[model samples]
Target: MLLKRLIVCLDVRSKRVTKGIKFKGNVDVGDPVEMAERYCNDGADEIVFYDITASAEKRPIDIEMVAAAARRVFVPFTVGGGLRNVVDMRHALLAGADKVSLNSLAVEQPDILHAGALAFGRQCIVLGMDARRVGKSLHFPSGYEVVTHGGRCPTGLDAVEWGRRAEALGAGEICLNAIDTDGMRTGYELEITRKIADAVGIPVIASGGAGTVEHIADAFSTATADAALIASMVHSGEYTCSGIKKELAEKYHLPVRLTSN
Candidate 1:
């Protein structure tokens, strides 16, 4: 069995790690570089840094911050937000991000996905999808629409169809974040997660609404997700990455990398 991964996400705005509910009322949490190092030490498998305002502000990502976090962590790190083209992707990688996640830009110009994959290899390209449940329509048969600009804009694209297209365009992985459940910590939107996971061959990382250990296990087993992206639970100092991994191994019988007790 493949070992399920536990990834910690740091949503940065104005260079500080922040957390919000449904992408609104965001408040600064701490320094992102310090938080990344803390999570890495807590045994997180990977770290995802999203410059939450970069795309909306129409500016470049904080490459210096990415480099600072990369210097502090030993594990793989993914960076996203404000990355528009192949040149931006290359700069992110050069600044120490193992992968570059594309969302709004990918939706606007899909060919960038093909270009980035060809230029940097598919493994370095991650598709960050922010999806919200919408009423069923001809355009959105799945009733899930892709949202961008930090969940402020909605594109009529169906979430599952977008996942398929991203995979076809050479995205090595997809991070599916549910707008409704973000920071709520109730659980993942299993339906949409499973839908995208089943529709795409690449690994799907379920994001948003991971409140408890059970929720994490459900994402892996019920949703069939390859990884879980956590923010509030870890960011609020309520749970540790090692603790979650232990629960998954002992209670859920899920394959996870356990640390020495």
Candidate 2:
């Protein structure tokens, strides 16, 4: 059995890690580099850093910050936000990101997805889908619409359909982040997660609303996600990656790497 992964997410703005409820009213939480290092030491399987304001500000990701954080962690590091083209994706990889996540830019120029995958293997190309619950509609059969620009713009694209399209376009992984559940800490939006996971062959990482160990375990069991992205739950100092993995391994009987505390 493949061991489930626990990834720590750092939503960075102004070069500082930040967190917000429903993608609004974000406040600085800590330094991205420091947090990445801490999570890596705490046995997090991976670290994801998003330049949360890069798309909204219409600028490139802060490469300096990415390089700094990348230097601190030994695990895989994924970076996203404001990547406009294949060149930007290349720059992020050269800056030490093991994977480059594309969102708004992918929606604008989908060719970048194929181009990036061709330029830097499919495993390095990740499709970060920010989706919101829009209720059932003819256009969105799954009742979830893809939102971009940090959840401020709705693309009218169906989340499940987009996941399938992206996988066919050569994306090796999908990070599904629910805009509605972001920072709410209730639990992951499992219905949409399971839908997308079943639609695509690539690994799916469920993001947003992870409040407890049970929530993470439920995502793996009920949603069939390969990994879960955690932010506020760990950002607030309420949980540790090692602690969560231990719980999953012991209580949930899920395979996870065990590290000595």
Candidate 3:
């Protein structure tokens, strides 16, 4: 198996790193640059910054914040939200994001994914899928629906099929966030996660609901996720990137990357 990654997520709202439960009731957490630097220094394999309200508000991502984070964070950094076109994506990459995540824009205009990949190569194109479990239905046979605009709008697209479409459309990766379990501190939605992971040939980063070392372990072992996205656990000071790595390595015997370099 490939070495599983431990990625730290920072949701930026009004320049501050904020987090919420199931995409609601968000509260300010900290500065994006400082928190990102801190986590990077703590040995995070990658750092993802989401301009949470950009798409909902119909604006652009904070490019300045992306540049600031790039100055401090050394690892691979991905930025998402409010990227509308190839020009916006170009600005973000120029601003120092290693990858640009496409959620709302990609859902509404999937050709942007092809355009982005054509311009920057597939490695820089990441499809961010905000999936919520609505149970098995005729439309969502996988029982998971993709939500957009910060989870306020349901796209009526099945999460599994979306993953497959994204992969075919030149997306190098998929960050699958299960809205039902986001910030719940329980665990990843293994069912949907596994389904998407199985459907996609690209890397699937299982996001949301990371609470414990065991939860992260379950994501890799059971859900078959290539990477795990963590927020509440590390942001709350309950777990550090180093400690999580140690636990996953020693106890669960998972192949977590042990070095920052």
Candidate 4:
């Protein structure tokens, strides 16, 4: 079986890595390139650099800044945020991004995914869906609803249905980020993650609310996610990627890297 990965997320804003609680009250952490190198040296399976403010700020990804972060990491890196079209996608690739993730733009114009997948391989494209817990009353017949534009706008689209559409559009992976759990570090929303994972054939990376190693183990075992994306826990120096991997291997006998972090 392919081993599940532990991904470190660098939420970059204005070229600096930052962390936030519940997706608000952002705090500066360090330089993006510097942090990327640190995580790589610390044995992260992969790194995801999200220009957290790109969409909200209405601008393209800072290519120079992206290049800076990409240069520091030897492992695969994924870039997202502020990417609106094929041109932006190409630029991110040229900046050393192994994969490009789309969120706001994909929700606004889904054709972008198809076009990107055609230009780049399906494996090069990832769909990032930010979902919130809608009250049982708000749950439409479709499934759980997803919000976009940094969770400020409700798309009213079912999260599971959206995952299916993204896969059909040739996205090789889905990053299902639960806004409700973001930065809370409580644990992953297993039910929501499983819903998205079961809806799509491609790999699903669970994001948001990972405070303990047991949460990581529970996500993969119960939710069947291909990987877990962690932010605050790692960013704040609570645990490195290797620390989490060790717990996964010890408790579940899951295949996780034994490298140093």
Candidate 5:
């Protein structure tokens, strides 16, 4: 069986890792490169870095920081935020990113998903979809609206529809984040997570609102996600990747990758 993945997400701003609730009021947590190295050794199946302010600032992600992480950590890591085109994605991959994620830019120019996947292969391209619970509308029957610019802009696109489109465009994975539950530590937004997961064949990584190990277990079971993206829980030092995997394996009897630990 393919073991379920536990991913640690580091939202970066000004070269430092930051945490925020609903993508607002962010505070510096640590150095991005340093934190990534710690998580790599501490048993994160994969690590994801988001240049949290890059899209809002209209600048590309910090390639220097990505290179620094590449040198320090020996694990598969993904880099996202403000990637404008294929050239930008190439730069990140050359700098040692196992994968490059696209969010706002992908929604704005979906062809980039096709282009990135064509140039780097589908496995190298990930779509990080940040969505909000806007209730159901005629346009968004799924009750989840796709939001961009770190949840500042509502695109009027249904989350599940976008997931299906991204998959058809050659995206290898979808990192579905629920803006409403982000940093709340309540639990993952399973409804949207499952909807997107079911709507697409590509692997779905359930993100946002992971407070307890039980929440993580719920993601793999009820949500049927291939991976769980953790932030506040591990970012606050309240949990470790190894510890979470242990709990998921032993207590929940979930198929987690404990071998790496």
Candidate 6:
């Protein structure tokens, strides 16, 4: 198996890193740059900085914050939120993001996916799928549907099929976040994650609902995800990046890099 990564997520809104449950009632966490630096210092494999309200407000992601966070972290970084075109993708890359994630913009204009891949190569373009369960099986077109505008509006698109399409469109990886499980601390929506991972050929990073180290283990072992994106657990002091890595390494015998290079 490929080395599984443990990523710390920073959801930025109005220049602050904030987190919320089920995409609502967000609470301010801290400064994006400061929090990112702390995570980088704590041995985060990679960092994800998302301008959480850019799409909802129909504005571009805060370039200053992106640049600031990029400057503090040496590890690979992914930036998303309000990427509307190739220009935005280029801008984010220029600002220091190793990869750019597309959510609403991809749904609004899927050609952007191909355009981004063509312009920057597939390795630099990531498709961020904000999905929710709609039915019995958690199957795309039947169980999972796309939610946009910071996961507030339903797009009525089948998420699993979209994962397949994202891979075909040259997306390097898929970041699948289960809306229902987001920040609930109940555990991941394994069935939903597995379906998307099985449907797509590229790496999938399972997001949302991870409350424990065991939850992270379950995500990789059962859902077959290449990585897991964690937020509240890390942000709320429930665990540190090093703490989680230590626990995972000891418990699952998985390789976890806990030292800063």
Candidate 2, which ten residues in sequence have the lowest lDDT sum? 65-74
Residue 127 lDDT in candidate 1: 94
RMSD of each: 1.1, 1.1, 1.4, 1.5, 1.1, 1.8
lDDT by residue (tens digit), candidate 5, 1-261: 898999999999888899999888998899988888888788888999999778778888899999999999888999998689999999999999999999888999999999999999999999999999988989998999999877889998999999999999999999999999999999999999999988898999999999999999999999999999998898898898889989999999999877564
Which pairs, if any, clash in model 5?
none
**Candidate 4 lDDT, tens digit per residue, 159-195?**
8888899899888899999998899999999998998
What is the per-residue lDDT of model 3 for residues 1-261, given as tens digits with 9 covering 90 to 100? 678999999999889998999888998889999998988888899999999878768889999999888899899999998888999999999999999999988989999999999999999999999998898989999999999875789999999998899899999999999888999999999999899889878999999899999999999999999999999999899889999998999999999878653
Residue 227, model 1: Cα distance from true site in angstroms: 0.2
Off by over 4 Å in 5: 259-261
Clash statistics: count for each candidate: 0, 0, 0, 1, 0, 0
User: Which whole-number lDDT from 0 to 100 does residue 160 have in model 1?
Assistant: 93
Give per-residue lDDT, candidate 2, residue 38: 91
Which residue ranges in model 1 land beyond 4 Å of their true spot? Answer: none
Which of candidates 2 and 6 is the stronger one according to lDDT? 2
Q: Each candidate's TM vs. the true structure? A: 0.97, 0.97, 0.97, 0.96, 0.97, 0.95
lDDT of 1 at 219: 97
> Clashes in model 4: which pairs?
42-261
Task: Choose 1 or 6, whichever is better by TM-score.
Answer: 1
What tens digits encode model 1's per-residue C-alpha lDDT throughout 63-175?
99988877898899999988978888889999889999998889999988899999989999999999999978899988999998767798889999999999999899999
Instruction: Quote the positional error of residue 111 for candidate 3 in Å.
Output: 0.8
lDDT value for model 3: 0.92
True lDDT of residue 186, candidate 4: 97
Q: Which wins on lDDT, candidate 5 or candidate 6?
A: 5
Model 1 residue 215 lDDT? 97
